[model samples]
Every structure is written in C-alpha cells, then in structure tokens.
Target: MAKDNSFDIVSKVDLQEVVNAVNQAVREIETRFDFKDSKSKISFDGKSEITLVSDDDFKLRNVVDILESKLVKRGVNLKALRYGKIEPAAGNTVRQNVTLVQGIEQDIAKKIVKAVKDSKIKVQATIQGDQIRVSGKNRDDLQNVIKLIKEMDLNIPVEFVNFRTF
Candidate 1:
C-alpha cells in the first residue's frame, strides 16, 4: 500500500502590504505638485474597498496611477486590484472603486476547475470554500499538477500549501 499526497492552491493578499501602499500613496498625493491643493482625496472605505474622489477624470486617473505605483513597490500584483467603472457623483465629482480582491473569484475558480479536468490527470480536485484541493496516489502526479498550474497565466497569484502525504 502507498500513501496519497495532496495540496491546496489558493490566491491571497497581504493586508498589511496593502495598507503600506495606501499610506505611501497618501504621502505622494500631498507632495506631488499636480495633486497639491487639487481637492482630490483617497480613502479606504470599509476594510477591503478603496475610494478615490477627484474633480475631474484626468486627476482621478493620476491618483489611480500613483496608488498602482505604490502597490507595485509593495510587491502586490496589479491584477489583484479590480477597478470599478467611474461614475458621476454629486457636487460635480467623479468616483471610482478599487476593490482589493484577496481570494479566488468565481470565474478564476471555475477556470481552475476546468483546467484541472481537462488535464486528464489522475488527481481529485475539489473546491473547498474559496480554494481548490488536489489529491492523488502518487507524489509525482501532485507535483505535475503544480507544474501545469504554474505554466498557465491565471492572472492571479497562487500559492501551494499544506502539502501532506497520506
């Protein structure tokens, strides 16, 4: 009898890094000449959403760029920041939503399931909550799944953890 091997694949973000990036963006907005006294502001609404308010679309875009730069500096992937459509608000203002997506979205999770099924690998894949777990009889098969996942560009950062030999 041989032991089974298993691992979980997940996409997660470091909240602290996100906070650091936001802080840096605030400092830049204050010092940058273009944004100085521009009446534009950046704030984190709730815990996972970032709201950017500006008088015009151009200035709003600039602020978004500044925030993106900070996120990059903090080693957070740009794809993880999902931006909503810009809309008009009262007092002649424009607002946009920046959602910090920490876990696997529905679409991405489905894609992972489909890819695993199409691979024809002899591993069992189950979606547990927000993540997918893969298990198989051979260690080599599990490693192969990991390699296959790495080869695909899912546009999300995936981490492998809790590997165990049953």
Candidate 2:
C-alpha cells in the first residue's frame, strides 16, 4: 500500500522578531540627528499591532523606513504587515498602525485549494481553517505542488511546514 506524503501551507509572523525590530527602530530614531529633537516613536502592542508616531509626515516616513529595514534584517517578511492609513494624532503628530498578519485569509485559502485542484497534479488539497493541507501518494507530485505554489503570486508570504510521508 502506498502511503501519502503531505505538507501544510501557512502564513505567520514571529511576534518576538517584530518586537525586536520595533526596539531597534526606536533606538535608531533616538540617535539620528533629524529625529533627536523631533517626536518620533515606535511602539508594539505585543499582540498584533505596531504604532508609529512622529512630529510630521516626513519624520513619519523616515520612521517607517527605519522600521522596515529592521524587520527585513530580522528575516521578517514585509508582506505579513498590513499598514493602516496615516492619521493626525494629538499634539500635531502623525500616527500609523501596522497590523501583523497571522494566518492565510479564507479567500486566499480557497484560491489555493482551487489552484491545486485545477493543476491536474495527483494531489488532494483541503482548506483547514487558516491553512491548506496538500497530500498525495507520490512524493514527487507533492514536490511539484510545492513548486507550483511557489511560482504563484499569492501577494502573501507562505511557508511550507510539516512535510510528512507515511
């Protein structure tokens, strides 16, 4: 009997890395001459949102750039962040919120399943809550599916996990 090979596709961000990134950004802002006297700050809510505050639009953009660089250096995918619109805050400051994405959205999960089914690969794909599981009797077919998914422009960062053969 041929046992199935399987893997899971998921999109998740490491919250601790995000926190570290924010801390690095804050430290950079404090030392930068332009931000020395300006009110620039980055704060993380520890759950899913990061808040950025600066004295004006220019400083706000600079703050965002610093944060992004730190995140990239930490190997955190930029796609996992959803940036909210910048808005005016108290004391003539500008503020923005960045929401961390933790899972594959339902619509995207459905699209992944449909694409797998349409590809004519000898595999079965099922959407299980926030992730997709793909399984097949042939290990090669499973690898092919992974290649196909990698070639797709899903607009979200995905990681393949739990590769198993039984």
Candidate 3:
C-alpha cells in the first residue's frame, strides 16, 4: 500500500517582524530631515493593523514608502499589506491604515483549488480552513503541483509546510 505524500499551503505574516519593521521605519522617519518637524508617524497595533499619519498626503506617501522598504528588508512580502484610503486625522494630518494579511482568504483558496484541478495533476487539493492541503501517492506529482502553484500570480505570498511522505 502506497501512503500519500502531502503538503500544506498557507499565507501568513509574522506580527513580530511587522512590529520590528514599523519600529525601524519610525526611527528612520525621526532622523530624516524632511520628517524631522513634520508630524510623520507610524503606529502598529501589535496585531494586524498599522497606521500612518503625516502632515499631508505627500509626506504620508513618503512615510508609506519608508515603511514598505523596511518591511521588505525584514523579508515581509509587500503583498501582505492592504492599503486603506487616506483620510484626515486630528490636527489636519493625513492618515492611512494598512491591514496585515494573516491567512488565505476563502476566494483565493477556491482559486488555488480550481487551478490545481484544471492542471489535471494526479493530486488532490482541498481547502482546509485557512489553508490548502495537497496530497498524492507519487511524490513527483506533489512536486509538480508545487511548481505549478509557484508559477501562479496569486497576489499573496504563500509558504509550503508540513510536507509528509508516508
């Protein structure tokens, strides 16, 4: 009897890394002359949201750019961020909220399953809560599925984990 080989695909972000990135961005903003006196700020809620406030839209954009660079340096995928619309804040500052993506959305998981089925690969792809499990008797087929998924432009960063060959 050939036991199945399997792997799980999930989209996740490390909140600690996000906090570090936000802290780095804040430090940089404080040192930069353009933002020295300009009310530019980045605040993280220690969970899934980061808020940016600046003197105006231009400064706000600069703050976002800095924060993005810091995040990238921390190996955090830019796709994990969902930018909110800029709006007025207290004291006439422009504020924007950036939501950190934490899991594979249902629609995206369905899309992944559909893609796997359309490929006609001899593997089973199933949505398991906020992740997807792919299993097959042949390990090569599993590898092929991984390659196929890597080729997909899913607009979110995915990681493969819990690979098991039984």
Candidate 4:
C-alpha cells in the first residue's frame, strides 16, 4: 500500500510570548518621557485580550504603536492583533481593547481548502476541526500547496505541522 505525504495547517499563537511582549510594552510605556505624566497604561488579562488606557487620543495611538512593535519583535504577526472600538472610559480617559487571535476558524479553513482546490494542485485538503490537513501522493505537490497557501493573505498566522510520509 502506498502511503500519502501529509501535513497539517494550524493557526496558533504562543500566549507566553505575547505575555512577555505585553510586559515589555508596559515597561516602555511607564518609562517613556512622553508618558511620564500621561497616565498611560497597558494590561493583559492573561488569556486572549489586552486593554489599553491613555489620557487622550494621541497617547492612545502611541501606546498601540509601541505594543505592536513589541509584538512584531516577539514574532507575533501584526494581523493577529484585532482592535476593538476605541471608547471613552471614566475619569477623562480613552480605552481600547485588543483581542489576540488564537486558532484557525472554520471560515478560514474553508478558504484554504478552496484555494487548494482552485489552484488545480494534486492534493487533498480536509478541514479537521480547527486545522486543515493536506495530503497527496507527490511530496512536491504538497510542497506546492504549502507555497500557494503561504502566498494567500489570510488575516491570521498559520503554522505547518505534523509532516509525515508513510
């Protein structure tokens, strides 16, 4: 029996790395001269959300830019940061919530499958829960599929895992 070469595509972010980045951003925010008396603050809930509070719109933008740079330095994709509505908080402050993307959604998985199919590549793409599995007889075809998917501009970060040939 000829076995297939297969690999899995998954969207996963290292929360620990994000936490470290958040910590770094907080430190920078606290010590920066511009923020010395601006009452700027950044907080992470240790899960999948972050909150940014600043005295006004200008400081808020600065804080967001700082956090984004830290996240990119930590290897987190900038697209993974989804910003919520910037609303006014109590005591003359502006607040914004940032949501961290964690996994591949079903819609994205479907899109991957569609792209693979559309490319006329000789591979099978299956949506296995939160991940997509691609398998084919030709390893080269599988490699091509990976390349094609990477070229697509999906809104989340994806990782290729469990590459196996049997």
Which has the greatest lDDT?
A: 3
Task: State each model's CA lDDT, in order.
Answer: 0.86, 0.93, 0.94, 0.92
Error of 2 at 15 (Å): 1.0
TM-score of 2: 0.98
Query: lDDT by residue for model 2 over 25-129, one digit each (tens)?
Result: 999999998887798999999999999999999999999999999999999999898999999999999999999988999999988899899999999999888
Q: 1-166 in candidate 1: lDDT tens per residue?
A: 9877899998887888888888899888989888776877788754689988888999999999999999899998887778999999778889998887777777888888789889998998888888989999988889989998989888878888899997
Off by over 4 Å in 4: none
Provide the TM-score for each candidate, comma-separated.
0.89, 0.98, 0.98, 0.96
The backbone clash count of each candidate, in order, is 0, 0, 0, 0
Name the runs in model 1 displaced over 4 angstroms: none
Model 1 local distance difference test score: 0.86
The CA lDDT at 41 in model 1 is 79
lDDT of 4 by residue, 1-166 (tens): 8789999999888888899999999999888898988878999999899999999998999999999999999998887888999999998999999998877898888999999999999899999888999999999999999899899999998999999999
Q: Which scores better on lDDT, 1 or 3? A: 3
Candidate 2, residue 55: how far the Cα is off, in Å: 1.0
1 or 4: which has the higher TM-score?
4
In candidate 2, how many Å is residue 21 off?
A: 0.8
